[model samples]
Target: MKYQEFFSITIEHSYFSGGPADLIVYPEEKTRKLLEKQGFLLKRTGTGIKVLLPMRDNNRVFPVLTADDLFAFHVLPTSGTVREFTDISEIEEDNMILFTNEGLDIGTIELIKSETVKEEVFQNFPALAKIEIKGNQITTDVIGTPPVYKAIFDSKSIKWKYYLLSKSGATDIAVETRGDQLQFNELEIGNNSLDPIITSLRLNFPDTKIAVFESSVAIPLSSKSIKDIKLIQRDSVTQTDSILMKHLPNPSIYDQGIQIIKIK
Candidate 1:
């Protein structure tokens, strides 16, 4: 099974902005032919396999499908532009706002994650020349007179698990602007605390807010993000007033008590 990404866009279409129209998907020659022969209108763009939905709600999620699975596509008049998703990692803290296809910028949305952040050094960000990743840290350099950029991701299992447990207790996660990106490390669940890794961007920028989430009806659960596999716990850890589920090959390890199992 393969997972495909899809974005939900809502629009109150009008003559000024754009008229209502169906969405086009599956632009590939072979795929389009197959789908067309099967009585379906579809297309794919250079960026990705198009699977457009009618404008209604605003949200983002990667859709899952098998290679042979065909998505129902309704071909309609192509209207409006796309505010392009630059990358899955991070974007300019300010540009994270919800924007319209026709250059309409809404107010900033909450930060998706407390770990990743990026910013421009000067007027026009230069093209990337090289990128190097070491462990949980990433280093990138642009073509000519631009400063180096750095990003840090916590790979340690115990620390981040503990951090999530701590932050879930009706507290706003605070990730301050240390150098260029947001950094935080007090995520330890063991007797010997692990060291926190903080990376920096050489340029100077204003301090941005990266919080956990707004205090509301949101309920936190002991689940890991599909993008990150480091949060999977194979062993038991101390939990004062929290829930921890085992996500290992051998489930229900707690019933067997703590064992000295080796990992590769």
Candidate 2:
């Protein structure tokens, strides 16, 4: 019910191959509460209380603020811990989840990043709404609807969605009629992590038609499911419906980047 329940800040670095901290700890009141719910309990020390993992017969000693030293934000190996900071001090991260409202038992959560409430995102569609949560309360600064980076009208929307979602950050894009005045309409959210290259992507999906929009997302031709794909242009480039038979590392794009794959 608290803001801390839905969000935590942590920095992720893939370069830490050497010895890393078993935990990245920034013990806050809300964080402590969550940990308690996760089976951590306080033991009476000589002078005060200390957060420790519930003792197991195996003598597994879990660490915390008073337990041990820790790194920024690495998985706990056997398990993972949340990395909440007192301030936004980290500079970089990859595919980190800032906030999520899943399993909250609430229908909708209006998250206002600014100081004044303006709009609420409903099912990825921005709409006017009231800002009220169970225990989370904050201000917001919303000038208007999210700005659209690029648009694809009645016949061209996938390219913009396909392109913007491929990158990180909230793509401030709008899909609407031609207006140089820079007005925006409804918007949509994208995947949390950037899509991987088609080749590196595991074809664990059903044997059905899959649409892969042409962005920088690439794949290899190792899978027999993908014999050869054609490149079609939907972006506002030199051609609207240009087609070219190309293989991996060169396929421009197809209509919505449709790849007919019969995954084995």
Candidate 3:
């Protein structure tokens, strides 16, 4: 035995407006075959339907079906202009239009539009040359005579690094550089005091934000808090922090306590 699920069906009709002359009923597979024998073709895709029909003067295609009262008709061409069919019970008359044939050829339209935009941009900016897109970075090379201008694709690269560190659950620290600035979200200290860490960081970065967090209440060395050090409270430090801080500048601690100090 097979179980069957009951479902309701809703019919949709194509019409420009709710008018007495715009009522249409689409043909079923059998009816479509009968119409095809008389000289009409129906093309259907996953999304839409198309109908092709012949006329007295020339052939025409209607992409939509229309209903008029108790009669259904396809759009046809009149003279050189296309118009909707108003006659009913004339399925043998080739007047219906298929949507698949009337709509803009999507592939060709996209190609043309893309080409047009590229050409327009190139023409407007004569200096524009090659464009390179990598992940979130976009680099565009501009044509120049002697001096080439290389610009950083994104200035937010530095800001994104902080977000990445936070997501990775990594301890953030501020490391001063000779030319570059190292910023972190959290830092861990070992046997050393916070004062030395600040001193070392300031010697390097001179301007950087370093935040520190520890599990226990560690007393920081007796010195003015640097402008770049920030201390917070954490439950504990991982072994990695302890090992890595050894190579870090000025990683000294006076005692175990919560201290937020900035080294400048």
- Backbone collision count in every prediction? 9, 15, 38
Q: Relative to the unseen true structure, what is the C-alpha lDDT of residue 61 in candidate 1, on a scale of 0 to 100?
A: 28
lDDT of 3 by residue, 68-166 (tens): 111112221112210121212222232221221112232221101011111111212211111111111111124211111111110001111110112
Decoy 2 TM-score against native: 0.17
For model 2, the stretches where C-alpha displacement exceeds 4 angstroms are 1-30, 33-106, 114-229, 232-243, 247-264
Task: Give one digit per residue, the lDDT tens place, for model 2 in 1-264.
Answer: 111111222222221222222322233345456556646553332211233445456453333332122111111211221122111122223222222221233322322221222232323422211111212321112532211111000111122112212122222222222232222222221343345533233344323223343333223211122323333334455335443323322221233333332221
Which candidate tops TM-score? Answer: 2
lDDT score, candidate 3: 0.26
Q: Which rank order by lDDT, best down to worst? A: 2, 3, 1
Model 1 clash pairs are: 4-63, 25-42, 25-43, 26-42, 26-43, 26-44, 27-43, 27-44, 159-187
Model 1 ranges off by over 4 Å = 1-26, 43-264
Rank list by TM-score:
2, 1, 3
Lowest lDDT 10-residue stretch of candidate 1: 197-206
C-alpha RMSD (angstroms) for model 1: 22.9
RMSD of each: 22.9, 20.8, 26.5
